[model samples]
Each structure stands twice: as C-alpha cells, then as structure tokens.
Target: MRAFFWAAWLGLCSTPLLAAPPQGFSFAQKDWELACDNTGACRAAGYGVRRGEVSVLLTRNAGSEQHLTATVTFAQIEHDIPADSTASLLIDDRDFGALDALDESHFRLDSDQTTALLQALTNQRKIEFTLNGQHLPLSSAGSREVLGKMDAFQRRTGTADALLDKGDAGDDAILPATPAPEIIAAPVLHNAQPVPLSMLQRQKLLPILTPLLNQRCDDWQNQAIPAADRQITLTALDKTHSLAQALCWRAPYNDGYALWLVDNAQLSKPRLLTTEASSYADGAIVFLHKERGMADCITGETRVWDGKTFTPSLKYSTGMCREITPGGTWMLPTFVSQVIPRQQKEADNLALRTLYNAVLKAQKSDPELSLNKVAEQFPLTGHITDFTLTYADDTLITTSKPSPDISDDEWQAFLRSSISADSENGKVSFTLIDLDGDGKRDLIIDSYVGGTGLFSYTGVLKRGDDDFAAVNGSDSDNGDDFDAGVPGALFSINGRGANQWNHWVKINGQVYALWYNGQFGEDNLYLLRPFSTTSQTPAVTVRYRYTLNSIRSPEKDQPLTPSLSDGDKADLLRSLEVMQGSLLKDRPASDNDAPICPIPPGTSADEADNYYSGVAVNYIYETVAYIPVWLNGKCYIGTIFSHHGAYRHGVDAEITLSSPREDEEVIGDYLISGLRHVIAITSGWKTREGDNGMQ
Candidate 1:
C-alpha cells in the first residue's frame, strides 16, 4: 500500500546597493600610478617611445554607459614610427581605435575616461603583464595598491573578477553547491494472519467492533462491493497482528473472508469484521441462491462440508470463472470468449518438436558448428548454464541446467550482437533471421567462441559441383603444376549459374580481391592476393583544391545546389579519384592479413562505414561548420582524423570551426554550456558528477 501528500509558501527584500551591476568599463593601470572609482572600475597607463613615445591606457565603466573612452600622450621625441602607427585597445577580443594623438608626446581617448576606461579592462587579483612572451613586473607601489584593491573587492563580494571589474558589479554570484540526498528502500510489512467470517453474522456485530479496528489500524479505504455480497477483503492488518508475523499472504485481492461459526442467537446484532483479519479477493465475491425458497449459496472458493451424515457426498467443491458483468457472477462460454484454444497446447508442442529436429540436423551435418567447437575456438569453460528462447509471438520458453561446452568469448560476443544473453552464467543464445531475404526463413547460429569472444555463422550449404575448376584440365597458368607450385591456392566451379566460378590464391599478407565472372579466363575465380601490395587500390582521395574551394567560396556557390561549370565540377570529381597504385611488386605474403571484403558493385559504402565507424563524421562536420558562425566571425574550416576506440571505432578526418567571443545565439545552438570551458570560453559552470562531485 502507498500514500501521498503536498505543501506551499512566499517573500521580499530592501537593499538599493544590492542591485545588479552596471555595464561598461570599470577598471585600469599605468607605468607607476593607477586611479579607479568605488564602482569597481580601473585601467593600465603606459608610455612607449620606440614608436613615437605613444601613451596607452586601459579602462572599464559599469553603469548604463554605451561608449568607452581612451586617452593617450606622446613624448616629444622624433622616432622612426610610421605615420599609420595608430594606437588601439582590445575589449573582450574586440579591437577599438584609440583617440587621435594630441602631440608627439600625448593623445586622448574619445570615450569617458572614468567608466569607459575601467570597463574595457579585466581585473586580476594580481595583474602580471607580459612583453614578447615574457613576464613583466608590476613592482611600483601604485600598481600594487590597485591590485590589492581588486583582490579586496573579489573577496568581499564573492563575485567573479571579470564581472566586477567590467562595471557589471552587482550581478549575483553562482549559488553555493549542495549535496544531494540519498535514496533508501521503503519499509516492508511482516507476519500476518487471515480470519474467516460470514455475511449475516458480520452485519449484526459491526457497531461494537468498528471503533476498535479504526483506532488500531491506519485509515482503510473500503473496497467496492455490492450490499448483497457475503465476503469482504481487508488490505492491512492492525499493530497487534503485524507484530505477530514476519510475512503473511492475504487473499490475492482484497475480499474479506468468512467466519466458521457465529453465536447470533445470543445477541441482538452480529460482531463486526476484526481489524486483524485478511481478505482474498477484496470485495469481489458475493453469494446467490439457487431457487427463490432455497438458502444462500457460497460464492467464494473454500473447502466445506455438506450437511450430510458421514457420506462420500458430504463434500462441496468450487471452481473460479470470470464474471460476465458487475453483480452478475454467471460462468458460461459467452462471458469468457477471449481464452486459449483447446488445440493451442498441441500445436505449440508440434512447433517445438520441429525446431528441435532442425537443431539436431544442423549439429549432425556441421562438424565446426557445435558448442564444443565454440569452446575449442574460444577460452570459456564452466558449468552448464540455463538457456531460454523467446518466440516472436511473445512467448518465453526457458530451460535450466543445459550441458555446457560453449566458450565464454563466443557467449559474450553472442550477447553483444543479440539482445538476450545470461550475464551471470555466461550463456549464449541464437536468433534466427532471413539473411538471404527469401520468403523462407534461415537460421543464424551464435555462440561463445571463448571466454572473451563471440562467433557467429550464417547457415549456408555449398554444393560440391559448384566448385570452380580450371580450364584445359590444368590448374597452372604456365606449364607449372598448380598444386606443386601454388600451395595456398584453391579453385572452384560455380554451378549455380553459367560463367560463374572463383579462384582463391594467397600471394601476400593481404587478401586482395574476390574477382568473379569469366572476365579473366574460362575459369571465373576470385583473386585472393594475400601479401601482394599491387592487389590493393585506393578508393578515394583528399584534393587540396577541394579543401581550398570549400572554404573560399560563398554559400551560394556550393555544389549541392544548381550544379557548376565543367572545370569546377571536374575538380570536385577529381578530388575523390584514386591517383596511384601500390609501389611494392616483390614483397612476400604474410599469414592471415586481409582487406575487408567489399560489397558488390552498385551498392554504397555509407551504411557500412557508419556501422564500422563509431564516431559520426557528419555530426562532427556540422558542429565544426557552425562554430565560427556562432562566434560572429568569418567561416573557417579544418579537419582532424583520430582513432576513437577498438573495433568499429576508427574516425576519419572532417572539418572543424573556431572563433572568439561570447555570441550567445550561435554558441547556444552548437556547443553544450558546460563544455565551453574546454573550447576557450572563460566563464562556464563545472559539470557535477554523483551528487555534488564536480566532473
């Protein structure tokens, strides 16, 4: 049984200084002296003579200011400074021009000197300037004083330096972290008993017992039942009954039970149902009479003795059936039409027998297709485990303690490929599918090859006559005997159709090509060059021209639209064309190294690549393409290729985008917020793991 509840509340405050910070320049510094307002604003002041003794200053303002001002002074010294040697300042990576030079030794910024000057600069608890990749010292007393003040402000308000120094001082800092509460299992009930009572007897004794039951048990919601019902089920027991047992099973439903005897003749009313009593069917069962003059008949299932004197017929039996409607407990075929058919059990048996026979035949025919073979191939060996079969028709058939010979590798692999596997006992199961796409189904055999691997094989039978045979009764191309010279070669005649045969030759470490048809000679054979580098070829190319054009051209000039000129189109096509063949001609063949089998012509490699390459290149490319656009910068793209994981984890090169700035609109769509920290963003929340632990 479960219960539920709810709660609610509200408030306000009064502090003018507690408002959000103003926007603009708020802080700065100079060669030896620094000046700033109480509103968290400052700047840097410096004079350079290498380029006409120009003076530079940095500042920030916080209020509702829209523009920033910079003032500069030039020393009265004639230098080789270029006429176009203009002064500039950067605000959050955005470059802005300084005011025109006042003279050879002085210049003034166009915006406000106080707020704007301070707003443009970032406040560091300790500012360390660098010259030409080398650190510079702020050893002056004024510089030290400014740095001290910034640190004091940061410590007092507990706000970020960037926010406070930018004149946006009043912005609330991040909330303090809190730990999450742990989840515990709900309490369980213990020991319970069932009591029986009759309908007429219960009604006569209800008033006296009702008060006692209410005080002892929690609130009880009565189950739905008709007034004429003879039985009622109690859900929970009182404290007295609960303390008496560890666990007790009540009626499947909530129906109260019947009492064996009632002393109704001695009292004016019958006793009420006890709070310690348990029910079977809630209030589902009710009694009915056979005839108008007959006594009431028992509706619920219970062993009862008939009022007959010591005879075989003195026993009563009852069976359960679905009720036709509310208050209408009639048992008939019309009321329970949705039932299992009589012949279903027999049909199911026949199907299982047929399946069993198929498996037996497969085991007999294939020498390498058994649990023992799987164990021999892989490293798994353990006790016989349980197995189960789930039919497509929603039926779960299970078997326990089957003979164990399947390897652990094969069993684990089988589970990885299929949805069902016993994680605890290391069992492997097979699922049959129509691999050939014929209307008739075929079987897929899967098992644990070893403790660490899984093996699968499609059930296909090869006809002997279909073997490829060499023409002219000679296996050798030259005068050499085929078997004597070509030790690792095999030929077979394709009997399925005309002009169909294949030859397998191990020439090098890689299985080169599987050639078919009579293209080469009368004997159609697959050329398997194991160690020959010439046997392999490049499938695609990455042309520098394509890469450059993709970046230089505008979006309207993309090839996916109305197409392009012959020259442009040819360049794009040439980008994907293979240009060179293997340079190795006399290399020796190695054992077992082979290229992936190629799909038949006319099919695309898209699906195959996607399945084998865990990283989705398209998704990566899209993310990269949008980076610059989001940063409000010119579109720039580059590619990166890296190995991701083992087996089906290789990733190919693709475009990447980069930019600088906090362009909310663009950044929000492409990059996740927490990941921004890694992407060069200065402000971002750390990801938390397992309660309050930062990830």
Candidate 2:
C-alpha cells in the first residue's frame, strides 16, 4: 500500500538563513543538517540546484508525524511559466511519484512517498528529481543517519508504534518481493480437510462453518490455512475463489501447509485469486503483464465490486512501463480519437486474467502496428515527441520503414550518403497540429534525413473525402539508378525534404526573427516591443539593451562572423537576399534511436561531423550568434534615437520617461533578426502586476 504524503506550507523568511536552528540538539551529518528544539521536535534540511533553486526539509514535531516539504524559489525567471507547474521524482530508475505546486514557490509531497524514499535511500544507488525539464541529483549521504535520528526522536517521545511504524524492520509497508499476480502453481489435493476454522474464527462464525482441524493455530499447518484467524470466508457466500472457505489440502507427506488467512498474502498468481478473501475490501486491483514476458510490468486495472458484479474504474501500471519512461513521457504518441475503447472481460473472469487479455488485445489493435487498413480502423496514437511540422507538396509524412524489396547492397549504398548512424534514424513519428491556424489538427512526420544531427519534419496526408491520404513523394524525382541512386525528393520513390516552420511569429503579417544568443551582435539581455499607428508601418520599441560583461560590449554595426566555412557563408548570404524574414536557429538533432546503438567506451556525439558522422551521442547544443541581417528598405539597424511620434504600446507604462522621450517612439521599420525571442515570462504573488518592473 502506497503511503499518502501530507504537506504543509512554511512561511519563507526573507533571505532564509540556512544554519543550525538555535535549539537543544543540532548536528550536521554529511549532506544532512539538523537542528532540534528544547522539545524532541527536529528539523532536517538538504537542497539542490539545476535550472531553478529548491530547498527540501524533513520535520517531525515533538509529538507530530514525519513529512518532507520542499520550498521553491527562483532568483531570475524571465520565462512565462504557468503558476501550477508539476515536477516529477525519479529514484534510481523508478519514478517514485510527482510533486504538485501549492503556489508559485511552494510545493508539497504526499506523506505516502516516505516509504519509497526510504527504500531508494537504503537500496537504490541514485536519486534524480526533475522540475520543468531540468534534472538534479538528491544527496543521500546522511539520509540513513538522519532517518535513524528521526525514528529515535519518535521513540524518545513515547509516540512510536512498532506495528504501524513505516520505517520499522517489522513493518510490511514496502513492496513485497513476492507480488501476487505472476506466480503459477497448482495446489495438491491428496489428504484435505473439508473445512478448517480455528478456535478464533469458530467463535466468530460458529453457525456459518464447521471446521475439521482442531489443532492450535501454530500446529494447524497440515494444509496452509491458518487456524488462528477470527474472520473467515463463508463457503456458501462465495465459490469463485478456489479456497471455497475450505481447509488445507496436502500431498502424501501433508507438509508445508500454511493458511492463506493474512490480509496481504505472499501467494503468486495461479492461487492468488483463490487465496484472497472473496469478500470485497475497498476495491480489487488487477495486474496486467507485458506482451510476451513472464513478468507483469505493463498496465493494471482497478475494479469495484457491487455484490453481484465488478466494474472497472481506472487503468494503472502494474510496474514500470518502457513506453512511459523519462524520455518517452515527454514525447507522447497521437491517437485517432481521444476516447479509446476498453476491452471487456467475462463477468466471471478474475481481474488478473481480464487485465492480461486487455494487454494482448492492445498490442494487436494499436495503430502503431502500421497495418494498411488497420490504421484506418482502431488508429492508436504514434510518437509525437517534439512538435515539428513540414509540408512537402501536401503529404503529412511521419515514419519511414525499410522496403522489403530493397537488397542489402542497395541499403548499404544508401547508408553511405547519410551522416547520422543508420541506427540514429527517426521513425515516422507524428503529431496533429493546426497547420493553417484553422484550429483543426493536421498531420506532420519526421523528415529528418540522416546527417549533421539536424532534425526537421515533412508534412504528408492530404485531407480528402472523409479521410487523410499520403501525397506521392516519388513521382517528381528522376534518377539514373532506376536501381542505384535516387533524387533528393521528399515524397518520391527516392527523395524528400519539405519546407518547415521553425518556431517563429510574423509581425504585421511580415516575418520577424530574433537573435538567440546576443543582441547588438553580442551576447546579452534585451527587450523589444512592437506597436504602430493604424495608418503607419509597424514600428519597434527596443529597450533594456545591456551586457553582463561591460568589457565586451556589443556594437550595432559590427560584422558577425565568429567562424564559418565558405559554403556556410554562401548559404548565409543567399538566405539574406530576401532579407526581411526570420533568422533560423540551428538546432542539433537528437538520436532518438541512440538507445539501441552498441556504443563504444569514451565515445561521444562531438566525434560525428557530417550527415553520417558521430552517430553515438543523444544531443549536443552548438553555440550560434545572431545573423547581421541586411534588408531591402535600407533601414540600418543601429543606435537608439527616439523620434517624436505617438504610438499606443510603450512609454506610458513607465512614468519615469523624460519629456519628449515619453511621447517619442523609435520607428521599428527595420525588423530585427539574430535576437533570441522570449520563451517565458516570470510571474508570482509578489510580481503579480509586474510591480517590480525591470527589477
């Protein structure tokens, strides 16, 4: 049983001074720091920093319960983050659980997670927690000592209960080694008692049953039913359970007989349902095993019994699912319909068997099977890790598979032309988006031709008479190798590359791009706002232009060629011809298939250079500067000189603006490129209305 974690919000004092609290017992053990008051109340703390900052504390009052609380505080957040953001916790490879924010900087963990945390600390080698995609490790150096102290503190205060103590060695709260569903064994039926009830149960249900075993609980082990339990399963009331409220059945020796009377038993599957008390207790949870494994580790079902029938309430995981991993969780698959059908089971079937049947059915019916007509039927969702879209002719391309007709020589020849390792190729993973802004989902697929680690997408599947169809990519390309080489076409029998939209927005219906790394052709922070009068051209109001390192200040007209190849310089020049457009940010591609590659020791992605080079790494970011754009209007992007003009965008927000400058607006005729766009904005209770403007 998972523990329910309880949380409490601590009032954060300004500039939290993290030192030993002034109290009775205070000690610092490795990473664990603790301070206790005159009473036995103790407070322990530890913290971590990744993309953001957070502090974790485990506290136990003189007579209160133990719980872990985390305080989140960001020093500089400029991104637009929704107030309610959730963070996930992973102890070693197991996902212990998730943390929901109580407020902008306050989050609480359910007290229930304490068991998992303790297990991970004592058994697992690593613990990683992720918030907003940033990962950091949790220190467990002094966790054992700290936990021991907490347990000791409770004992000292006379509030500890051995039976209910979660951290105790005698408690059975941790995940049992012999989990019920997967076992397969048959009970022997040689010498068996018709009904076995101990003195305790006989006293409680004397009128309902007549027991054949007359020995004491400990000695009554001829079969396996404990002769000590007070409550009993009435045979007349339930029969589906193999036990049928009966005795212990054994072979010739009639040894190793133990009662299946424990509320939480140790029996494996075949006898699990029969061993369990047929009488309902809360609800029945069934485990679903994998597609072709002896282990039950895929999905599960929770059903509620209403006397005569069982109704499944929800589906859960029996164990860790590969498809729902650290990376897989981020890249979700798309399904044809949001509403999926659940496989119905026989009314008399056990929950465990019912769940297993559902798993097998899902494997065969899911759209991922990629069957010709099956895709149109019960079309399940496919991988849509990153939201990328492309349009090649009109096809919404996704996955590409090896053609059965292609020979080994042909495949080998094809592999030589690409840069990414053949194993690093992307499947036609797809997602639906409003491609035309009409609010209807359009399909997009991976158009990432191997090489140089740059991932892009190509659109396929044209909408037609009540269906989506692929646009033929092979028709236009002409090739000399009707059998050897092919054209660089995206949809053709040989090639494909579709025009794609990299995250950018058009201002006044005109493409406007931002420099990602720096401003003024230098790395720094700045803000740019765009607004204009109804009749005039849209203008920009650029402000907050500054550098963190004043020594390397940016100059408006400086050339921006840090390093470039002749071909790259040429490609950059041609892209500037119709200069009034967005500058493309060079994003390195991810080897989604790298997990399957047999990587060598000390090998990394940096070794790969071309479309087919260093194919071993997952992802590596390459630093790029802003492009010095030259436009047709000849409006040189230079110094800031506010001209007398009135626009309804800025200046009014700041009453500190000087005379003339208050009403003057810098004409934003020149669309700025090479500037990084803002991804998020920081907001909180303190800065609710941006009261701390420019702070």
TM-score of each: 0.15, 0.20
| Deviation of model 1 at 131, angstroms | 81
Best by lDDT: 2
Judge candidate 2 against the unseen true structure and give its global Cα lDDT, from 0 to 1: 0.30
**Ten residues in a row with the worst lDDT in model 2?**
329-338
lDDT, candidate 1, residue 183? Answer: 16
- Candidate 2 TM-score, C-alpha based: 0.20
Scored by CA lDDT, what does every candidate get? Answer: 0.25, 0.30
lDDT of 2 by residue, 283-322 (tens): 2323232432322123333343333333443232321222
Q: What is the C-alpha RMSD of each candidate to the true structure, in Å?
A: 36.1, 27.8
Q: After superposition, how far is residue 632 of candidate 1 from its true place, in Å?
A: 21
